[model samples]
Target: MLETILKSAFEWRNQLGLLNESEALRIFYGPGESNHPELQHLSADLYKDHLWLTAWKKISSKVLDEACEIMTRILPFKIEAIVLMDRSVVASEAEVVTLRGTSRSGRFAVKEFGVKYLVQMEKTKHPGLFLDHSPLRFWLQQTQKNKTVLNLFSYTGSLSVAAAHGGARKVTTLDLSKHTIEWAKENWANSGFSPEAGDFIYGDTFEWLPKFKKRGEQFDTILCDPPSFSRSKNGVF
Candidate 1:
């Protein structure tokens, strides 16, 4: 059963672009005889091919990691901001990030000069740093040089800190949960930034967004990363 399953999985993998690069059929099962374990026996020569087994294991591991990295690169950050399952993140600066997972957290500086952003996976659904929104943040930094920025549904306020570093006039954050707001504030402070630069508002975003918009008040720049789906007494937004 195991051998049959493995063979079928390999065939499916080839169909899925996982093993399409190589002619696996020619390499694994030449015209000499059956190379599939399922067509042979448990202790057959095919099963005893230590080199083939080792190669398959290594290649599979590599492919899995590569696939994950590609997916992570494009996957949008979830609107819901929660604690890292067994890890945490600290932004040392606009160009530097530190990720501490269940085992360890380390800092790495990144610049768009010529290097790719270093992504750190953590316990949170989101990795330590969000990369997909790189374009959005870059634009904010350029256009919000001296404008007040409001970041709603701001989990870590990574955007807030980015704006501050980019010389935003002011940054305000509103989140119903106090803990997430505090963490956002902490991240801002960790970069040697001023607490005064940010005002953490603790409340429901739906109530706060409309209220702020109604006060004849508006920020020069606003960055809102709202949950995919949310509900309130007023209605779902």
Candidate 2:
């Protein structure tokens, strides 16, 4: 089973070049709707030298050993570390399993469509950016021009950066977490954008939405990607 995963990872290595030379890639995604039924609960993503694994259920020690061995044998570069997470647990908490190698405690960058996002592996449940939204980012980069973009529930502001890169006149990012907003600022800076390039709002969307309406503030393009469930002092969304 592990050998099959190794082969798939190796095959997909070249596919990253299709997106960008230096960027994160989903080496394997075997969760729901995956062809590999045996590995239907496993997913792996590669960011620079790091590997992040997530599973719907707890993985056994023997499976972990086999995975480590196969990864070491197939990867051309030195594997810096592997972070494992149980989706059921991490859905509510940010805790993760450091399966192998040294955990990165500082800022790390992951490129996508030439934009760089600064991510902290240990600070949050998500590794700064959501890989599934790469296509949307690419689309925004190609379409936004002289437009105002409003990104609601913007985690680390990856989409906002994309809109800015696409020549949006102004970008506004709103999120509840101050830490994530700061991290988004770092990503903006890393992508050759200044903090002044975009407006970062640290507040609840529900609270702010009505204010935006009352103030008559309108955006040409609005991107709303909220979590399935969220809690705020005023109410839940």
Candidate 3:
């Protein structure tokens, strides 16, 4: 048994007890963990009954099957399904497959601190919510009270929704993807906000930033977190 499996199983077994059925959590981190070079290719996340396995490097089918089998036997959750996502290739070409059970709709609701967000398991490479930013989102929810907030590069508007949920007078979310903008709207609605609760801008942020500056627009808080390997209009694009 690799240390990764033992550590992951232990963590999942214990952590799920602390959270309700509505939450999402990172079971273990391995890819960049200097302590675990033996299986740096893998990491896992828990969303309700499902488990998402992200492979930062390609693993042989035999090894992957073995890993999945071990995972099913040890995890205490209901085991709705186990999803493997390969992050070793181009984002467009990355592979996502189910090794056990089924995701049913490939989408489910995941919560953080009782706040709801939609998880699209197979839509894109991302599993709806970014588990790494759970604290940041919670911070936005705690601090933005009766103020205006701007979330730039807001994929799915998770931060914006958090700000609104915390009583922000207004929240504006800007992103390049209309698809994700709509998805963001769904997330906002999932968090118990009305569809008309906030502003969702679907356009190039570069163009919109200049326009906002020209208008002398201001926000009490601004959140900017961009994806690492994004495609700008041309390259990013």
Candidate 4:
């Protein structure tokens, strides 16, 4: 069952050249594998030099071993590592576990539509870049020209970077985490954007939305991608 499932996954991967090479890809999504019910708990993403697994539910070590062995044997290119993210636990306690090999210095520099983002594998809740949003980023890069953009709950400013790269007149990034604001600045700088290229807001989304509304601040585009709870200083949103 494992071998068949993985083989089909590779076949799907081989056919994904239809997507632009510059965009990052979620090569194998497990829940989308509806035929094999148990395999739905797992998904795989291919990065520049590694394969990343995300598990929503726990499985036996034997099943995990089989999956890793098959991936290592079947993949054509040499991989730096095969990492697993066990998301069965709450985000606060989630772990990025390396099941096969080690990532170089725990950082893998990846690109989407020619935009650079440094992804971390070990000891990080998320690797900074979210591969699933690849197409949306590409859309922003193509469509945001000469527009003013606002990114709410922006993490690491991947979207803002895309919008700015598309020649948006101004890109404003708002986030609750100061770390993410700094991280976004680093990414923007890495992509050849000046520090003054964007306005970074470090505050709660609930508080800021009303303020923006009251102030009559208008933007050509406003993006909001919040976490599950959306709990903030004001309350749940």
Candidate 5:
């Protein structure tokens, strides 16, 4: 099983030109339609200095050993850590299983499309950025000039950062987590945008959206990516 995974990873590296750069990337993806029939339960993501492995089912020690060996052989740079996670759809929290190396405390930056985002690998289910949304970021960067943008359920505000970078006149980011709001500000600063350029609101989207509407606030563009389920003091979404 490990040999098959390594073979596919090496093939993907060559096909994707992954080894030519030291950037965040999805080295492998499984557990979905992209998965190979035999390796349908595994996935991997490279986050700057870390290698994040994920599984939809139980993974054995032997597979972990082989994965580490293969990663060492394929990577051009030394990884600071190799962390495994459980990404089952029904799982409520991301479970970390440190297969090798160690991660530093607090947040670190990962670059994509020349924009830097602050990520906390051990802290949240998504760590701070969502790599799959790169195309949306690109589109926002190209088209958002002078627009008033609103991002709801704005996790760490990556989309808001994208909008601001594209010269949006006003960008508003709203989320329930105060910690993530602060983290989003760090990402905004890292991307060379003024903190004052963005309005960071920490509040429940269900509660805030109506308030914004009542206040006659309107946006040229709005991003609404809510979680599948959520619970707040006001109600569940």
Candidate 6:
């Protein structure tokens, strides 16, 4: 496992084009007594202060929060916050709400302006984060006023809440899982946005999307984050 982690870190370094290769290598190995003097420059303190464990799911919540703090320090503009949500939706005592449900079972979670601006986890090997799109959230805050926004695959509806904060006229969220939609509603409520401000649709987006299009309806803004692959009640859309 350790060898795999080191290999993964090396691959990550290569992919990211990080300038400090040795420093990253030191983090991958962890602090050891037999380290060289130059490697001594790479201390746990240094790594802990800047490096993030965005992909570590088994890590405890406290450690993940610390990592997110470090990640914000490293890339603040790319992250507004981080959270770890798993099948066990309830964590950190954040108020939870049940929106809808499916035959099989899944859930979503929401947190208020609690603290850290980014979260890391590994429920499905994808962190509960969309840091790559933080810039778009800021865009919404700056431009989306009195406009309706539709968040498809609204996993937790963070965008919907952000739109409401930006004075969106209304928002609609669609997702397959009832638990997630419910969690999104809770998040909207926690953001001090009225539940009525955004309508929650629980079912296949394929069915919903064309229906809205056929109604000659349009959204001021639309956001989509489809899973790498998924199937809907109607067909693969």
| Candidate 3 collision pairs | 231-236, 231-237, 232-235, 232-236, 232-237, 233-237, 234-237
Candidate 4, residues 108-154, lDDT tens digits: the string is 56777677776766777777888877878889989999999999989
Clashing pairs in 4: none
- Rank the candidate models, highest TM-score first: 4, 2, 3, 5, 6, 1
Worst 10 residues of 3 by lDDT: 31-40
Clash count list over all predictions? 3, 0, 7, 0, 0, 10
CA-only RMSD, every prediction: 15.6, 2.3, 2.6, 2.1, 2.6, 12.5
Candidate 3 lDDT over 5-44, as tens digits, reads 5555556647666455336877666754434433567877
Superposed by TM-score, candidate 4 places the C-alpha of residue 105 at a distance from the truth, in angstroms, of: 3.6
**Candidate with maximal lDDT:** 4
Q: Which segments of candidate 2 are over 4 A away from where they belong?
A: 9-16, 19-22, 32-38, 90-94
Candidate 5 regions exceeding 4 Å error are 4-22, 32-38, 88-94
True lDDT of residue 116, candidate 6: 19
lDDT of each: 0.47, 0.79, 0.77, 0.80, 0.79, 0.51
| TM-score result, candidate 2 | 0.89
After superposing all C-alphas onto the true structure, candidate 2 shows an RMSD in angstroms of 2.3
Estimate the overall C-alpha local distance difference test score of candidate 3: 0.77
Overall local distance difference test of candidate 5 = 0.79
Q: What digit string (tens of lDDT, one per residue) describes model 2 on residues 78-185? A: 888888877755576747778888879988887777778776666557687787888899999999999999999998999999999999989999999888888878
Best by TM-score: 4
Cα displacement (Å) at residue 188, model 4 = 0.7
Pick out the ten consecutive residues of candidate 2 with the lowest summed lDDT: 13-22
Clashing pairs in 5: none
